[model samples]
Target: MARLVRLVRRYFILGSGLHLVACGGGDSTEPPPPVTVTITPASATVNAGETQSFTATVTHATNPAVTWSATGGTITGAGATITFAAPLEGGPYQVTARSVADPARSATATVTVRAIAVTVSPAAVTIGAGGTQEFTATVSNSTSASVTWSATGGTIAGTGTTITYTAPATGGSYTVRAASTVDPSKSGSASATVTPVAVVVAPASRAAFRGEPVSVSATVTGAAVTGVNWTASCGTIAGAGTTVTWTAPQSPGNCTVTARSVLDPAVASVSMMTVRPAFLVTSLGDANDGVCSWTHCSLREALTAANADPGTDTISLVVPAPVGAAVANTIVLTTSLPAITTPVHIVGPGADVLAIDADATAGSPRRIFEFDGAFAGSLAGLTLTGG
Candidate 1:
C-alpha cells in the first residue's frame, strides 16, 4: 500500500511538469506576439477641407485602443475608428491607425473626392427684344454638387440644370456664368445675345385713288407680331391686324396711312394713295336761199335760156344799185338769129304755165307772155331757186 501511494505522488508531479512545459514555462517552442493591423482603402481623397471616415483592425487584439493620425492632413479618432480631414490644397493624403499595445503595428486607408466641371449648352443664343430663352447646363466629375447660374447683364430665372432668361427692352449681348455650390472654383460659363426687331413697310408702294377703298399688307420682321393698328387721313379701319382696308378722302388729293405692330409699338410702316375728272362735244354747217327762173318761147325753151345765161338776172340788171344798163350784165341765151333777154318763170303743179319777160325798154313796148302747154309740164320740177 505504501508503494502505491509513492507512485501516485510521482505521477502527480510529472503531470504538473508537463503542463508547465506545454505552457512554455520550461519548453523550447514559444508562442508568437500579436500580428500587425491592416486597414482597407489604403488611401483617401476628399475636397479641400472635407472629411473622410474609416475603421482600423488588428490580429490578437481584444477591445484594444488605437491611435489615429494623417500624414498630410488633419485626423480625428478615438480607437478603431478614424476621420481624416483634407488639406486646404487638394492632393493625395494617408490616414494611419496603430494599436496602443503594439505601436509598431499600424494600418492605412485612402479616400478620393473628384473635382467638378460644368458646361452650358448652346454656348450662345440670340433672342429678339422682349423675348425669352431657356438654357441647360451639364455637370461632370461631381455627384453632389449644386450650381448657381446667373446672367450678369440680363434678366435671369429658374434654377439647377434648366434655366430661363428674358431679354431686356433694349438689345445687346449678355454674359452668363455658373459656379458649383460646393466648389466655386470649379465652374464654366457661356453667353447669349439680344437683337433689335426690325420694322418693314410691307407692300412697299402706296399709290391709290382718292375715295377708293385700299388694302394694305404689312409684315413685321425679326420678331413675331400679334396685331397691327392702322391710321390714315381717311380714318381707322376695323380688324386691321396685318391687313388694313380703308376708304380714301373724297377730295382729289393724296392720303397716307401708317401700320404699327401691337406687340411692339415702336415698329411701324407707311403707304399713300391719290385721286382726280374727265372732258366731252355736240354741232358743225349753214343754208342760204335765192332764186333762178325758167321761161321762154316754150317752158322748155325758157328753161334752156335761163340756164344758158346763168350770170344774168332781171332783178340784178334793173336794180338802181347798179343804175343804167351797167356793162350790159347780159349773157347769150341761144345762137338764134336774134338773141333775146328773157326772164323765165314757171308756175303750176301739172303741165306748168311758163312766163317770159321779153324785150324791155323805157321807150319801147315790153312784151310779157306765158307758154301754157303740156310740154311745159316736163320742165315743171326744174326748181332753180337762186344762183
Candidate 2:
C-alpha cells in the first residue's frame, strides 16, 4: 500500500505542467469575413429628367440595406433596388450603391443622359379661310409642362402648352410650331392647309321712264369672282355679265335687278328700279281690240284706235241710236278683242241707258272687258255683263 500512494503523487504533478503550456497563446474569437459589392445593369442610357432602376448585391454582408447615391443625378429608395433620376442637363454620370454594413464595400454603374424629345398633336390639319385650329406640345422626359407657340400665317392666341391657329382670310398652306420650354433646342411643328371661301355681291339703285334704257352695276368680294347673273322683276335685263342693260317694260311700275355671283353660285345682290306711267284711253269699243272713236262704235274698236295713236288719249263714249227716236242704245259684240295693255278711262252715256249688253256674244261664257295685268286704268258709267 505504501508503493501505490507514491505513484499517484507523481501523476498529479505531470498534469499541472501540461495545462500551463497550452494556456500561454491563441484568441477565442476570429475576425469577420471581408465583404464585396456588385451592381446589376452595369451601365445604362436615359434621357434628361428620366428615371432608371439599379440593383446592388453584397457578398458576406452583415446589413440588409444599401446606401444609394449619384455623382450627377438624384437617387431615392436604398437597398437592392435603387431609383436614380437623370439630371436636367444631359451628360455622363456615375451612380453608386454602397453596402451599409461596410462603408468601404460599394459598387458603381455608368449612366448616359440624352436630350428630351418633343411631339406635337394634330401634326397636320385642313381648314377654310377664316377658320381656326388648336395645337398642343407634349414633351418626353421633361421637367416643365409649358411650351411657346408661333405660326407662319394668320393670327395666334394663348402662349403655354396649348395655342390656337387662325387661318388667313386668303387661302393657302401654312405652318405652326410649338417650342418646349423645358428644352429650348427641342421643338415640334405642324401644317395647316386653308381652302377657298365663299363670295358676296352688291348692286346699286336705279330709276327711269318707260321706253328709256337703264343699266345696273355690282361688285363682288371673297373667292375668285368672275361675272354675275342678271334678272329683272318688271323689266328685261339684256346684258350677259355683272353690268346689264335694262329695257323698261312697255307697261311698268316698280322693278328689281338681281345679280348673282358666277364663281360662287350662292352669292347674290339686288338693286331697286322704278318705271313712270304714260297714256290714258277712254274707249267707245267694249272689245279689247285697239279701236277708238267719238261716236257709235263697239268698245273694242275704240281701244284699237287709241292704241294706234301717238299720244295718250281718252275715249269719249256715245251709243249709236235712231235719230229723234227713243230707241235702245245697247251695243253688243260677237268677237274677242286684244287685252287692254295701255292705261284707259271708258266714259259711257249714262249708267241707266248705257248697258253694253252681252246678249250677242252670250252664247258662251265670255269676257266683255278684260284688262292686261300691266294696265292701270278706270271704267266709269258703264254696266258690263259676261265680263
Candidate 3:
C-alpha cells in the first residue's frame, strides 16, 4: 500500500507542474502610464464688439476639473474658461489638469486667441443749420456683440452702424466715438462739420413812367436755398415769381424800389427814377395895329419885332392872334422855358407898308415862320408860331 500511495503522489505533483506551465501565470506586463497631457480649445476669435471664450480639458484624466490661465485674456469660473474682453489678443496661454491619486502627476495644455477688427463707411458727414445727417459703421468680424457709441461732448443720434445726428445749433466741429463690450481696447472715432448758406437780391438803376411797371428780381446762393422774398417801392404787384411790377405815383418825381432774398436777408438791391413837368399853350399877341406885320415883312421879321419889344419881353408863347388887333393877349407858358427880354421898334404902317397878324395852327408849315432877333434866354416869334 505504501508503495502505491507514493506513486499517486508523484503523479499528482507532475500534473500540477504541467498545469502551472500551461497557465503562464506570472503578473501581466502593462505599458507605462500614458504621458499625461491636457486638452484645451484655443481662445475664441471674436469681432471687435462680440464676446468669446476659451476652455480646457484633461486628455486622459481621472478628474475633469482643471486649472486654466490666459497670459492676456480674462479667466472665469474655476479658471477653466477664459473670456476675450475686447477683441482676441495675441499671447501664449496654458491649462493644467491634476489627478487626485497623484497630485504631482499633472497634465498641461496650450491656447491662442486671435484678434478682431472693424471698419466704418463715410467717415465724416456735413449738415446745414437746423438739419440732420446720417452715416453707417460696420463690424468686420464676430457676432452677438455689444457696442457703446459716444459723441464726446456731442449729440448721438442712433445706435449701431446706421445713425442719424442733428446738426449743432450753429455751425462748427463735432466728434464721435464707438466702443464694443467684447473689446474695450478696440475703439474708433470720427468727425463732422456743419455750415450755413446765404441768399441775395439785386435792384435796377432806373424807375419807370407813371403807368409803366418795372421788374424786381432776387437770387439765392450758397449750400441750399429754397425760396426768396421780393419787395417794391411804390405800385402794387405780386410778391411771388422772379419779377414784381412797380408803378410810379401820379405826381411825376423821383422814386426808389428794392428787392431782397429771403434766405439771406442781408443781401438786397435798389433802383431810382425822376419825374418832369409838362405844359400846353393857349394864346398869343396880334401883329396889325402897330404891333407887327406879316405882309412885306417875313414871319422871321414879325418874330424879331415881337421879341425885341420890351413890353412883351416876358410874355409866354400862345396859339392864334388877331391879324389886326391890339398888342395885349394871353398865352400859356412852358414850365422849364426861360423868359425873354428885348426892345424893338415898329416902322411899317399903312402909308409906306402894310402889317397883319394871325394865330398859329398845330399843322402850320415850318418855312412859314422866319425870325432874326436878339433876346435874353429863348424867344418864340409870331412868324415862328406860323401866324
TM-score of every model versus the real structure = 0.46, 0.38, 0.43
Model 1 clash tally, residue pairs: 20
Q: Global lDDT of each model?
A: 0.55, 0.69, 0.46
TM-score, model 2 to reference: 0.38
| Model 1 lDDT at residue 219 | 71
* Candidate 2 lDDT tens digits, 269-299: 7777766443222333355433222223456
Query: Model 3, stretches more than 4 Å misplaced?
Result: 1-39, 42-44, 49-53, 58-64, 71-74, 79-118, 124-134, 142-160, 163-196, 208-212, 231-237, 241-243, 246-387
Task: Please provide, for model 1 over 1-387, each residue's C-alpha lDDT reduced to its tens digit, 9 standing for 90 to 100.
Answer: 999999999999999999877898556656776667877666655566577777777778664777887767677757677677665445566677888778988877765554567887778888776677887777665544468888766677888877787766455788777777656776777777777665555555554432345677777655533466778765345565777676654344566677876656877777755432000000000011122211113223333334444332211111112224322122221212112333333332221211122334455543233333322211232122111
The candidate scoring highest on lDDT is 2
lDDT of 1 at 366: 34
Which segments of candidate 1 are over 4 A away from where they belong? 1-40, 45-51, 56-77, 84-112, 126-134, 143-146, 152-159, 164-171, 175-178, 184-186, 224-234, 250-256, 272-387
Residue 116 error, candidate 1, Å: 1.5
